[model samples]
Target: MRKKGAYQQYKDVQIKTANQGKLLLMLYQGCIKFLGLAIKCINDKDFEGANNYLQRARKVINELMSSLNMQQGGEIAENLAMLYEYMNHQLIQANIHKDTEKIKFVKKLLLQLLEAWQEIINGSNTEENIDTNLSINI
Candidate 1:
């Protein structure tokens, strides 16, 4: 026997869950967009632009993390957490050394991540759907 109120509550929960998933997807895509811009800035030797993009990227990562239930997110989440830390470290080192190469290396890694995400978003079964190269067309 199903209670009427319980069924309504369950329906509400389903809608909320769907909305949350959409929000997560948006956040991930936002991160990738900012990361792509950051790569462009690096390649163009625009340190200020690159730094601004990094701030945006950090915000996106924070939003993505807030959307997750840590314990339930499993290995992918764990790997992302670690990669985020590495990305932060690389950014700091680039700032300290004023090293364009460091920024390039970091941007390459981020590009790979973004391209992989795009592949998944496009319903590709693997990350190979997009070339991970960072060359600028313009």
Candidate 2:
């Protein structure tokens, strides 16, 4: 097998070493990226490319939903699971119809969630009571 590229190796290390909070942020960023790419593909009339990107975004959302710690997260996890399901459905419709607007809406929601996650992670890091390494499982 061919050796991994430098960037690939770096990403591997990053993922391996990241705390649960960081991993969650990475998932959100990745989903937003895929959604943006899908929008661009739709604008360029590349339905196949759009479908591929939307599928990738859906996978990320699924991963996020699966990672949630429902027992500990309580109502928050339940709400997030519902939202993720909605986003996945929107992505499916967007892929079928080649709808840039729907993709844009999903991207907007992801961005908002990313910002909130970032703040939560940052705030938690600043507090000594919170363990950065603790698995929130999100």
Prediction 2 global C-alpha lDDT: 0.84
Q: What's model 2's TM-score?
A: 0.91
Reference-based lDDT, each prediction? 0.60, 0.84
lDDT of 1 by residue, 1-138 (tens): 966698889866755764332334455566667767776887798878888877787776665445444465566666777776777677677655556666567667766766675455455333232112211110
Write down the TM-score of every candidate.
Answer: 0.52, 0.91
Best by TM-score: 2
Model 1 ranges with Cα > 4 A deviation? 1-50, 124-138
Q: lDDT by residue for model 2 over 25-90, one digit each (tens)?
A: 889999999988888888898888888999999999999888877776678878999999999999
Return the top candidate by lDDT. 2
Model 2 clashing residue pairs (backbone): none
